[model samples]
Target chain A: MSFSSTDTYIVSNALQLAVDAAVALEKPLLLKGEPGTGKTRLAQELARSMDTELLHWSIKSTTKAQQGLYEYDAVSRLRDSQLGSDKVHDIANYIKPGKLWQAFTAKQRPVLLIDEVDKADIEFPNDLLHELDQMAFHVYETGETVTAQQRPIVIITSNNEKALPDAFLRRCFFHFIEFPDEQTLRQIIEVHYPNIQQQLVTEALDLFVQIRELPRLKKKPSTSELLDWLKLLLLDPPKPGQLREWMSDEQRQSLYGALLKHEEDFPQLRYLRQG
Target chain B: MFIGLLQLLKRYGVAVSITELLDLLAAVNKGLAGYSIESFYYLARTILVKDEGLFDRFDQAFYAYLQALDEVDISERIPNEWLSDPLVRQLGQLDEEVLKQYESLEQLLEQFKQRLEEQQERHQGGSKWIGTGGTSPFGAYGYHPGGIRLGQASNRQFSASKVLDKRQFADLDRDAPLQQRGFQVALRKLRAFARSGAATELDLDATIKATGKQGGLLDLQWRPERHNATNVLILFDVGGSMDSYIEQVEQLFSAASDEFKNLQTFYFHNCVYEAVWPSAARRGEVAIPTGDLVQRFGSDYKLIFVGDATMGPYEILYPGGSVEHWNEEPGAEWLNRLTHHFSKAVWLNPQPQQRWRYYPSINIIQELMQERMFPLTLNGIEQAIEKL
Candidate 1:
């Protein structure tokens, strides 16, 4: 199904407040929520709404602060300097701007989405805080401070793994996005994957609501998972002769992972597997 | 308009009865409209004052709102009043009961000791156990005729000549504790900094004045001295689940307390919400009054929140999930306020590096912290201290 602006649902007043702040303050909005709460997709939607370039930075545990700003191309610089030492005197010429710097210097204000910031080290957040605070960063090699011509709207996402320092939080407006309710989740599924039967949609949402209440699950199934499940059911609708064929084995296994996380939860999934 | 006036009074932290709220609301030009202004006034007043009956009604209304919004059903209980007289009385009674039980336990222990001594005497063959292997005067099991071994033959006895020479064993002093080494290194660095004159500028005016007293002839030699005024706010997580990592955390807490000037410590569990008390034992004692807290310490202090952020994610999302007390807002709100007040802040997590990813609550906190949470390693602590 083709997506539209009206299709997007804003559940909480807090989220609306955050969006308003982002617009008023002209600052990067930082979103914190659970894993399946559509934090990354919000950035995509925001980019679509503003008609801006969405520069995505998927943060990992090993992500470094310097990597976000600039990278040093030492190999090429070393070759040139060695081949022609007298000609290539300026050693600082090897620095190349990374995603953050590129977005800052872009002609249009890009949505710089720093996804899963909690995965990055403490230094990374500290580094970003300074940049966010001043809207500028200094390149030691160039001996010049590069300021943003147009401040890129930055969105940081985290599934609270560790307690972030308060100093860094003060720099940005914060918002928590919770999981959508059953009605909203159903609407999302129907809007995203239209071919699914209404009955199937209702049944899936009912099952999802029930499953979410189960304490053993690690991460609740998100909107994306709901759509995925519907797509699978539509591709191979349940039949008396081939009830087992309704969900592909691979899809079924992956679905279980999304639904069940604990050993005790396996027994609860017997009904789903039986059909 | 009357309801609005009542709300104003409530906001001003006034304790108004239901009738008073209605009267105040009625006094205003805008009297009770079609809606139950009296009811709404009472509801809002009870919510503000946190009256149990009113609070329950407010909670029901909140739940209804959540239901309408299609949010998850959050089944949580409102925290009991920490300052309730009944609760305090019950705690005192419990303490008294515990003391009485301890005394009874001591008496039982003495009786057990007496029985043990009698058994030992009987085992040593006190003239009556030679004929039969029956129950002796001690009223115990089989015994040795003359206790198993006597004098030099006893394994328990250690003679001075039999003691092992210390020189033959490995020298334990050579391998000192890591904490000692770290302390020594820190001391050495402090001494070096002292010697290098990386301190306050000398008081030239005072020196010149002193020299003038000696007929303008220079008698005093000028040297810079260190003006060490390090202000530290160490927010330690104590009580509840924090009991597990008390030893290591205590070490760090003590170290920071000794090293920094103006070092203040407060106890919190999981995450800080609203206010933190000075002592964990008397969290509800009102030791640091709310007014005093806000006045004495604002945002200028450097805050260090020490805890393992292993809590239900709802603790930050919901108001009532906190362990110590029910906060009106989520823990994040308090954290945000703290950040606004403190120029520098850092979180120290004792949980190891590998396990942080598994906990959603910790992940959420880390994000709130702007990814400023660091593992509580030796190097991490040092870096944190240096940053402070």
Candidate 2:
């Protein structure tokens, strides 16, 4: 769903302070929030407003520092070297820049989105800090230091899976994204799914709020999850045996899995369904 | 001329892709305080673009030169302000001096090694320990000093004294029940005097005020006054990893409940977030509403957060990291707010005091709570009481 920056809820003054810090510092802002709190979408919107290319790098646990900077095509380079001995020592011929380096050296500034940075190993953040600090990096292979001609807006996101080292955290401007309150949640629902009836919206919101308050769940239903479930309900409004019949085996299982993390919570859901 | 050559080479190094040359120029530009962009550009175009083929070769050479310069600059700067920064200064006085000494000593060791090896070869199988004859040079035969003893080895072996593992302090049974003991001692002292008996000490101020109301005639009806005990809100972290210490911590909680008249108990996973509920039975189900909690408990309530502050530090940085449900904010923010609302709050960590320094999460929590974290021991509880 398309959400304007104005439409976003200003829950805590801390979040606004973080945004202001990012703008003042002119650095890529790192938003650390719970999963489904729209940390990623915030960067996307910011990039859109700035008219910068959003080069997203979805970091995984296995993502390496070198992989983020550049990947060498060793086999291709070797073949080319064999074919032409004259170009064997050419530095530019072998250089393959990664998103971080490309964004820094881009003719027009781009937004380098390092998503889920906490998932990546500790070394990844440490390696990025050098570039983040000076807005420049030296390519050792070619003996060239690529500085930002037009600095790309850098945004790093973390789910707080682990504590980032102080050295790494000190380099970037940080913000924490909080979950939307009931009013904000209602606004979001109205903005995105306007077609849904008011009664359905209220019922869904009440159920969603109750579900969030349920102590057993690991992840509270994020706004995105609420919207998805709302869509599912609207497409096929519950009839007699509708929840059982319309909910495909896969769909039902997935929904159950999302809503409930523990076995004990299953019995609690019976009451929710009845209500 | 040198600057012009450097500028010329940097401008056209792209053809040969002398990246090193460009990097060197960039580094130099960064290092030079007042160097203009025009001068840097001029230097890059002049010396770097000698020929298209030479671009890559020049880049490598340029980088090597800049690196050597950087090393020299770093070495020159190391002994001054860099050494004074608290983080670097913490390496200990011996370490700082020894590191410099080792660099010089390494060369001397290499030089001495050659001479030692030659002497060893010439001596071959010669006896260094033996004197002229079969007997040793010292006084008697077998007059060996600093050697293994020959007599029956002493069965009285030296053993390290058993240090009580600090972790045992968290074990409720091992330590004396101070709360219970204190309560018993106080009760015993109070019980010594009969309830209706004349108080040993006269309340002169009360007697004077009574005289003001009535006549100055001595009206003696002695009654002992009982002081109300202070209320305590002990929020014990239970379940998950805390399951290990559940029995011991529960004993402490139970003892506290029995000892204090106004003792209230609650359970949390790691920290006290928005609200702590009363029903320990349905801890996972019901939470005491925030409004209700504030109304019921005044600023007088002494808050003791009992937990092993061992978790991913992110829980404090991000909201929604509770073991059961996503907390709205990092536990620290809630902790900060709670501390502001309540004057007397202390955190009792089960983890050893030494290890708390390493865990960033614990350190953060400790900092937020004004370093009022104490080990969960009898002494710790007493100290917490004193602080409150």
Candidate 3:
């Protein structure tokens, strides 16, 4: 009923269609994109739009699926047993409900964001297949089963580190967040800084694209980086003519750190920088 | 329609299963795409393809399906003689009923194939090549900037504007030069992980066990983290025949540097003989001898030879056959000694696999390497890694 683009988040038609399909089919949406392409932000925006609670499961290399479902604090339990505490009698007291368990038992439908899912081991996605499929997990400690009251919207983000198992991927609606084109990127800039001059926006975007397209650039500036550069530009506004001069001659430029993240990329930037 | 699209996708080597088909059908039934070709393309792609690497294949298949779907209807509407009428295409300019005249579909296709090559040459030379809306017999082969020039869709207003006009996977296309990311991903699969470093990482399991036994006292244990101890030595073919593949070999070299902690690189021209130099940059320095190279790196190091493998058979089999230097021993003997020393040895030929049979040197090298020769492509590298 509402527009896909809100005050901040701007969704493309293709992405909106993908979202709709995933939502209608009641399946987990697996999002793959380059770093800083707003994979995690998509989950937050979805939660905001749906007015649902968000449960984030930020995975690391050593993070196990068991931790996402529930974790038993054995150290605390052993200490409690030594102290002869009454809390030791009930094993549930030591059981800490994890992100998945919290999402499952949420009062309203919630958004479960598995941020950087690929950072975990290759078999990590396979381990959660059954639980994600049924939206229910078995707690062995208390012999209790936690089931979802309302099916939560599951969104998984991957940095494309490792190929996911086919079995896990088969159950998901996949969407690759393509780097935005000039028009969409312009819209994004407008959303961030509506009062900024149109000429400055055009020139900056041109320079940004030029820097990105420099041959074999080690690291390209991302959307957030562009916003940061723009913010700095707004603070110390460069004259239209000086901006052009400084942009071409790298030594004269003051705010290149915000755009060029890698030192290795500067050699090419200097060679390819346009007047 | 979905079955047709699926068949096309499968033909393009994108693995789309029955589950994906059902998912697509469900999305369609729910009216998520709202019956628009553009929306349906996105919906179908999202439902079917999981990996971004396969997105190129998916886009190709989908585009083919859309074009083929419209082609049938458009062809029926146009006069039969309009296309089947054979005329000689003089590069971009068409000559009317002159020179080579052919009417049968086979002969027409043969002519088109010949023109296709000429068109490629013209396109590469300058930007003034004939494209869509051209009077040439093969107007479809004319440049379209967006994609490979298909039939004149602009002539007649088509019912569906091709939703995906751009080749999304042009960078990932197997025929194109390999990118650094592709090389890194392939090299990642070749890794043989071994824990061989300082035991600085805390062993949590052992710590917890010891702490339990120590009775309320915290105990910490340290163990080594899994380190990539796999050593790699790449012998690159440079100068003469390998000058064209400099960019590709450099990408592979960079990727190898990022992936393997223990890596050694050497540059040889055409074939490895008595000596190979470390890098082109330090070529003024003394070249490392083949025997010294064998002694320097361990047997566990994976030996990869990157070349076109299209040199004269004499260069490999006979002594003093190297183009620049007269080798004391034949290149074959050195290759054999190196292969014997390093159990994991492979020859990566940048030349297409189909052309390998034409090059007798490649066959000889393959036989020597025990058929561990692979084409330098995404799939080829992965298969080579598996063999490693």
- Highest DockQ: which candidate? 3
Candidate 3 per-residue lDDT over residues B1-388, each given as its tens digit: 4898888888888888898898888878877878677778788889998887777677667877876643222222222222332222223223323312434434544555556555542122222332333333343323222222333322221122342222345455655557777787678877666776789876768978888789857666789877677889899888777877777788888899998988988888888888888877635768888889889888988999999988899999999998887788899999999999999889898888888899899999999889999988877898898878
Q: Please give the fraction of native interface contacts (Cα pairs under 8 Å between A and B) kept by each candidate.
A: 0.00, 0.00, 0.63
Q: Which parts of model 3 are misplaced by more than 4 Å?
A: A1-3, A83-86, A249-251, A270-275, B64-160, B163-166, B195-222, B354-358
Candidate lDDT (C-alpha), each: 0.55, 0.54, 0.76
Best by TM-score: 3
Residue ranges of candidate 1 with Cα displaced over 4 Å: A1-13, A85-87, A239-258, A261-265, A270-275, B1-388
Instruction: Output DockQ, candidate 3.
Output: 0.39
Q: Which 10-residue span in candidate 2 chain A carries the lowest summed lDDT? A: A1-10
The predicted structure with the larger lDDT, 2 or 3, is 3
Q: After aligning candidate 3 to the native by TM-score, how far in Å is the CA of A141 from where it should be?
A: 3.3
Each model's total of backbone clashes:
16, 28, 1
Q: Model 3, residue A232: what's the lDDT?
A: 86
How far in Å is the alpha carbon of B353 misplaced in model 3?
A: 3.6
By the TM-score metric, which is better: model 1 or model 3? Answer: 3
Cα error of candidate 2 at position B106, Å: 70
Measured as a fraction from 0 to 1, the native contacts recovered by model 1 come to 0.00
User: What TM-score does chain B alone reach in each candidate, compared with the true chain B?
Assistant: 0.46, 0.46, 0.75
Question: Once all C-alphas are superposed, what RMSD does model 1 give against the true structure?
Answer: 29.5
TM-score of chain A of 1: 0.84
